[model samples]
Target: MRDRGLDVLLVTDPANIYYLSGYDAYSFYVPQILAVTHDRDQPVWIGREQDLTCARETTWLDREHVLLYSDDYVDSELHPMEFVVDRLDEWELADGTIGVELDADYYTARAHQAFTAALPTGAAVEDATKLVNYCRMVKSEAEIEYHQRAAAISERAMEVGIETIGPGVRKCDAAAAVHEALYSGADGTGGDYPAIVPLMPAGEGTGSPHLTWTDEEYEAGEPVILELAGVVNRYHSPLTRTMFLGEPPAEAERAAAVIIDGLEAALDAVEPGVTAESVERAWREEIAGTTVEKESRIGYSTGIGYPPSWVEGSVSIRPGDETELRPNMVFHMIPGVWFDDYGIEISESFRVTEDGAEVLADVPRELIVKE
Candidate 1:
């Protein structure tokens, strides 16, 4: 807090709260904040009264450090930030500049307005967006271990997804099998729910990457894209692959080759002291003459995610990004390309090592053709 000149930091991002206090629950659907003050050794955990037991059980916070507001503050005229303002007054933490995650997913405008308006006179509110996320860019050994376990589950789930998807199989049924494999985990390690649902875009929908599956059955000679992640203890390892039920189109095969080659080139470029954009440049150079062209960023930092996204919101691997690649930083190098009717996505989740990139999953890095 001193480094940023923040007297108190009001953290609302669930993943960041989990990182700081080990406080985990579905309670992020409502108002909750972790208060980091300059004087306190532990960050204060503030939430609804109903989740008090959840905070006690999940967090290492002392009883006094974990505070809860009355039920009247939820979804009513009385906002939870008003209670937060009262606590700040009681603790005398509102006398200086306060930092808030202004751009967090769950930090609503109403909450911001309430909190800022209720603060004491002369107390400044500054934007500390992604501050905690940047702190999480580099993973520790334990965190890396969790990511490796998640990668194992990802490989298993992807195998199930590919095997279950066929000409006559329903897309929902295939998604179910993939989910089972993800939750069941591999090598006796249990899995956690991923930040994103299975993205199974098939046939013409393959051109759009973010489309989810429906009850529709698979058709012959069509491409299906499976984008999924395996989460272990909230850490995520995302994986994407393209499959064909029968004989695949020649264009798709060619694109797959280009993507795989470019992905390898990008992975090979990962090392300490290298800029993130350097890796992207390698991929672009490898596919310069190919018909497949990608405009979106290929990959991003991944770990310790919550609902809606697995990206860590730091260090994107793309052109013009100058973030330095440090050892132990993990990234999902996904170089996917889409055409008018079909798309190909073959990705790898890797960790930057002192030597080079350490690919996490053991899945075959190629297009899978099933007859």
Candidate 2:
């Protein structure tokens, strides 16, 4: 906080809150903040009275540090930030620049307006967007172990997805089996709910990236894209693969080969002291004259995800991102492309080693033909 000239930091992002305080719950639908300041050795946890037990059970803060407002503040005119501002004033920690997560998914505009308006004369609010997220770019040994376990779950879930999806099978049924496999986990490790649902776009719908499964039956000679993540203790290892129930079209096979080649080239480029965009450049160079072309970024930093996304919102692997690769940093390298009527997705979740990249999952890298 001192480095950024911030006297106080209001941590409102749930993932960031979890990162800081080890407080995890589904109570983020309402207003809450983990206040960090130079005045206190421990961060103060403030939230609704109903979630007091959640804070006490999940966080390491003392009883006095976990404060709660009355039930009237829940979805009423009272507003929780007003209570938060009052507490900050009472603690005498609000008399300087306060850092807030302005772009956080759960920090609403109304909350910000109330917070800023209620601040004391000497206090000011500044955008600290992604400040905590940047701190999470590199994984510790324990965090890396969780990601490795998650990758094992990912491999099992993907295997189930491939085996269950075929001609005459319902897409929803296949998705159910995949979900079961994900939750059941692998290597005796239980899984947590992933940030995203399974993305099983089929045939013509493959052109779109985020489509989920439908109840429709799978057809022969059609391609299906499975993009899923296995989670362990909120850490994710995402994997994507393309499959065909029958003999795939020649164009589809060719596109899949190009994607595989480019993905390998990108993974081979990962090492310490290299720029994020340089790895992407290697992929682009490998597929320069190929019919397959990709405009989106191929990978991003990922770990400790909450609902809606697994990306850490820090470093991105694409052109113009100058963040250098470092040992223990993890990334999900997904090289996917969508065409007019079909798409191909092949991905690997890897950690940057001192020498090169260490791929997390042990899965086949080609489009599976299941005839």
Candidate 3:
């Protein structure tokens, strides 16, 4: 952004494109750079003609520069370096320091190197994606509306998944059930991430969190862990719930209670001015003596895309994340527990509000039992 002291920002990441412009098509074959400045007149875009149509329809780009490439471009036969140079020369952008995202894809890096080499003497290539990501941390009004609808679809799919969990149901079948439910309820687009795929580890598979679905039959008293999400218009809501095919063992029941308690504790910590570290600590405090092993962060910000709210710039969840919990910020809390052959888990979506936070999904968090 121009306010961040950069004259122009070159965005190569797909998610970044979706964040800035509402362009979410899969056109990686064609290179794209979004030039942004505080002055609307100076803002521009560089991409292929097909992509330009989508950008023009949903976005507010001041100008767009299209490039034509041959089949050799894909196989590394022809490079697009010269094409960008002529455009820069025509735009008279040979003076200001140019900033490119550090995390550009390999193809984007090649194009960036070409641009730098071809530019006039004074132009400099700098990294400015951190600033762009910081801007994306906070959700806009339209972004929140997309996420709310996604969460609603995810909740309905989850409910359908819970109800379909009887004997003789294959893990993949259950995952399929969830997919169908969400797709029917949604506006006909795959979510930001894979939706309705139950990583159900039944019987011995329950011990590993990374286990995928199989044709394994549901047995009496066997714990079935269902991890799934529903994709609604390219947005996602992740959730995981465990239930008994018949009646779970007493030990599993106790673990479920502990996991639910931990989940609630983490959810309670999600208020304005709260730190990511503090949120994770709340879950640990609840499961202090429990046998479960915690792995990832307790939760993350959610918007149009899953994992869209990354800590942005740093790995440690420390103060540099001055990501103040502004109202309208959305988050997905996945507080889980790993206990021997069975895992206990709970998940939900929430939006930060003035008073506190609003729960977007109405799905019940109680231990779901399918008879």
| All candidates: CA RMSD (Å) | 0.9, 1.1, 4.0
> Candidate 3 residues 35-132, lDDT tens each?
66444553455566556666666565544333344444444634555555565566566566667777745346667666677788887777876555
- Per-residue lDDT value at 81 in model 1: 94
Candidate 1 collision pairs: none
- Please give the CA lDDT of all the candidate structures: 0.92, 0.92, 0.64
Report how far off residue 146 is in candidate 2 (Å): 0.2
Q: Estimate each model's TM-score.
A: 0.98, 0.98, 0.80
Q: Report the lDDT tens digits of candidate 2 across residue range 1-371.
A: 77899988999988899898988888889988999988788999889898988998888888988989998988898888999889888878667788999999999999998888888888878899899999999999999999999999999999999999999899999999999999999999989999889899999988888999989999998889999999998999999999988999999999999999999999999999999999999999999998999999999999988888898999999999999999999999998899999889999999999999999999999999987
Off by over 4 Å in 1: none
By the TM-score metric, which is better: model 1 or model 3? Answer: 1
- Give the C-alpha lDDT of model 1: 0.92
Q: Ranking under TM-score, best-scoring first?
A: 1, 2, 3
Q: Residue by residue across 183-264, what tens digits does model 1's lDDT show?
A: 9999999899988998999998988889999999999989999999999999999999999989888888888999999999
Model 1 TM-score (2 dp): 0.98
